[model samples]
Target: MQKNHHFSYVIGAILILAPMLAQAETKDINQTKFSKQYAGWAATIEQTESEDMLATYPASVILWAGSTFSHQYNSPRGHKFAVADASHSLRTGVAIPPGGNGKSASCWTCKTPDAPRLIKEMGEEGFSGSNFVDLGPEIKSVIYCSDCHVDGTAKLALPRPHAQNAMAKIGLPFDEQNISMQGAQTCGQCHVTYYFQPENNNKVNMPWIFGNTADAIEKYYDTRRFYEWIHPISKTPMLKARHPDFEQWSRSKHADMNVTCITCHMPTVTDKNGNDYTDHKVSGALIHFDQVCAGCHKSKAQLTATLERNKAEVDAKSRQVQNLLVKAHYEAKAAWDGGATWPMMNEGIMGIRHAQWRWDFATASHGMYAHNPKEGLALLNKAIEQVSAARDVFKQVSSQVGAAKPVYPDISTKAKAQAAIGYDEPAAVKAKQAFIKEEIDKHWHPVATTGY
Candidate 1:
């Protein structure tokens, strides 16, 4: 009876180990030798194993892995190198001393992917959690092909996980399909201009809480007293123009009529051989007039003529708006100098902010003047009216106070004006030089060709 029981136990153990042993043997045989005698069989086995592994993994993971592999082996590094070099070179000229004024990690937001990674690596200790100001010249690349497209596919896609996460926070729903269609939304997150406030240090921000419109953003800025710089001659706090791609598009007829930045900028093209594909080589829409504009408009000559007319109208209107903005600043300066209190200056400041926002949004849109010429011209004209009206109000107030005519600063020459503003030129140059050296050193190391 004991012998029989032992025999049963041994048979059961063998049964359990049989599959495991077979797998081991198969792996060994497949990897053991490379000879022409077994070449065909080996190739078949290898392909089967690869397919099995792929099947085992999630589809998304497999797709991402393939993309990573392609970027490592096939993509050209020239653009990467050029972008890094240019960014580093530019940074060398804008270095500030340690703990200097106008220093913030927020400045690096659009410049490099390294800034966020470094922030994460440092955690609580690095930037005091609010230390977006301390990142120091790290970010330096524009959005690239890898940012939006998958490997081996021409489909434009979203690459940033943070954006999806952000949208999720706002209760914006997304599925794989809708997310895929909304590729421009991903690019818009950063491509849209923004200002980071020191008060809102912990969050990557946009000044759109008031809303996405020109008036709304301007109200937010005015309420917060946010100023990019103070004019050296006029001494009025100046708001610098940032690229307002999304905001401008939001108000455009294309946007109002449901067109998007991707519609015009990332339009599809057909090769001479009649192969149609989305042209991913992004630039201002004007570059591919025939392909982009003429595809929709049958008459290329008419579209060109229309664009030229729109450009002329926009230029004239922009100048008018800019002049009014300058005049408003001067008039406001006069009011303040003549003892205008905070309450008294509130309306004037609000007017300035609104006019500036409108002007900035209109001009910041590189293709707006042509995309819907009539709308663009109309918006610019409205912006001029707003600023001109505001200036007139300021002039009336200044006259009542018997204030002298306020001096307006000339910003036409970049260098002279930069120095006049007490910007630390020497420190900026030093920091930029150091950044270039660091970038050069990275090229010397054996670069890892794969993984994020």
Candidate 2:
């Protein structure tokens, strides 16, 4: 036992010292040597762009890098859902089956390295890759250096296994030339427009049915007669929008002008003495406007003013749309109360769903206005117009029956609104508390008191 204890201590000491020794040696190495090694690997990756070679990098490296990058870039502002943004954007959330028994496993694809391991362990009881819903509460940790670059080098590459498989099935080799396509090829798997379908048991799926644009997404929703949920008071169907960051961003001047997320969110850093390196500090462009935006805009004051103007415009337009939605909701509720049948509710439901979807698309997309003020404003303006039209239709219908003043529930507070809507708030709260306690217990040990 004593011999084993001494061996364990020696191993622990070596493990602790190993990284320090490596850093010391790395620091001693001249810039020329480091540059040569890094540049050579980068050039080779750039030349080959081999999917197989890119796949060799451990998935854990990509997961850690993605989590770290998002922590630096996306979550520093203390937004309400910053952690969810990081994890979901990284594709780390567990899949919940859409409706059945709530079994989920398929949603793990593109998110975790342990996915295959878990599936294998489950054997016949395991979930097929296509059987899960995307409704897990907390986001999973994923995305890392390995997702887009060769380990220890700065060259960009692809890590999506599903894309590669699709390409392979069609007899089109996943080639080096196609590696740089930014949307479907790179960001689409996580960042593009999406909606959750309850039919798939509230599984999240990209609405690529209409292509990746605000108009395209809106048109698809209109055509499909789809909705996320029916408003209890209004009796109108509604659609909840997720973050369409990449899609909304694509409409921006920067994208048309050829400015990529990698360009700004991942700007190059310069040392005090002038040595340049990629910042690798992901976060809002507002945090590092001088480093990221000023490089292109030339006038800092002008660009800052533009961003602020854009934010105000977006907020104002968003509220206008919200008011329209609220009005439509009340109109529909009045019709339902006045003995309107399913057919009478159809148009109102469609209007409500479309309007809410647009609102969600605009609001959920973080930094969209600042990134591309003109396009963001334009989209919101268009949505406002649509909702206004919908409201006019609702008003016309309700005018005949002399509708009552709308009872707009207070949705500003989730708990109050949920309880008012007849949901079991106490049960939900208790379940959430129990889940949190279980999670804490699973991950940590109880602390002992030191009082006399």
Candidate 3:
């Protein structure tokens, strides 16, 4: 009797909320636009992605130029583009490592649904250290339902070992008992910032020992002295923040209300057959605010306006900090070129590195402002403050070395900026194109040409 009453109460509550949800624009929830097949490299640039993706920055800063990211970077299209993007990206060049080498298989971990199977065949460490080319032919599926769902059932599964290890570190165990966290963890599996553990076969590990906050992660990196690469111009050890969507959203207002990532991203919808199911399109919540927020929010238009206003504020601050950090890098280079001693350049180098790290942490997640406006703006302010201090150090150093003020160069365009940082853009594109013709074209069918 109690169970029946509880179920009735839930249904009645949904009925009451339906009128409130109807205030927003409606959608045909049955549609699925993205293909099940692999979307090759051309689709990422020519069709689905915006040109602005490649031009997110004014130019290639020294930190990016020193890393593989400068070779090719974009806003991710969707699950369909996973395997093809991983395989054909200029960053993951055709460098096949020898036996016992790492970083090869680590790249594919989050890009394919075949990961669990491959990891089962080879241990987590073995898979992480294996040659990427050796597993090429075996790559069959892109990210799909099996990644989070049970093989024959719709039940969710937390099969990713790396994700499990990360949660354990933060004292959140992934098991059958914690179904609510499991829903979010499925997305957290890839969305959180992580690094290749150098000593453990380059195994992917999240720096969650301290915690998930930006300060905690940065402290963990500082204590461990884990740097992604060294900037060529500033010679500062730099950190590259991978998409930290999970980290940004984990402690958000929505999360505080027990709203999981699935609640917003994969909203419930009915099929043509009148059967209801969770939509797997997996897009930003703002796109379908009616379906996601419903009774919890006002009209979609008002909510969207608020979100956009917040984003604009965050974007402005980000641009300000980015320009300052870029100047710091170039000014440090000027100090080096002018024969400044290591002691003189030390403060500026460390400042730029730390500042950039914070900036990237806040900006890397495409929807950071929407996810957590307070945290996003806080991080950008820190970046602005840090970069200003760094600029002071550079100014003092330049004077000590009898050098002129650093003149910002002609990096108005992407090509020009990358060139300024000494990255051969033409050569990278040419090589990537050749690789597609020879390797990718032969195996994968390019279905992403349409509706991309």
Predictions in order: lDDT? 0.51, 0.50, 0.76
Question: Model 3 reaches what TM-score against the true structure?
Answer: 0.84
lDDT tens digits by residue: candidate 1, 1-452: 99999999999999999999998876533123322212322222222111221122222111112121111111112222322333333322333457654334444444444544555666423432433323433444333443454423445444433445433443442344353336556566566656545464533456666676566666777788877655432344555445556556655566565556666765666666886655544445656767656656778677778778877888777767766765676678788788666666666666665666666677656456665556556667777767777677677777877888887555443333333344454565676556446633353221111111
* lDDT for 45 (candidate 2): 18
Worst lDDT run of 10 residues, candidate 2, spans: 443-452
Task: Give me the displacement of residue 247 in model 2, in angstroms.
Answer: 1.2
Q: Report clashes for each candidate as comma-separated counts.
A: 13, 14, 1
TM-score-superior candidate, 1 or 2? 2
The lDDT-based order of candidates, best leading, equals 3, 1, 2
* Candidate 3 runs further than 4 Å off: 1-47, 50-52, 60-62, 95-103, 272-274, 443-452
Model 1 regions more than 4 Å off: 1-102, 113-142, 150-181, 222-241, 255-259, 269-276, 286-291, 372-379, 408-452
lDDT of 2 by residue, 214-243 (tens): 667667776887755455656655554555
* TM-scores of all predicted structures: 0.63, 0.66, 0.84
Per-residue C-alpha lDDT of model 3 across residues 1-452, encoded as one tens digit per residue: 99999999999999998987884335212112222111221223333553445476655444486887876777776666777767766777753535444246888888776778888999888888876655665677666666786654557777788898888888877774366678888888988898888788888889999998889999999998888888887888988888888888887998898788888877676666886666666767876677778678878888888888998999898888877877888898888888898888888888887889888899888688788889989998998889899989988888888887787777676777787878897887787677566766665445311232
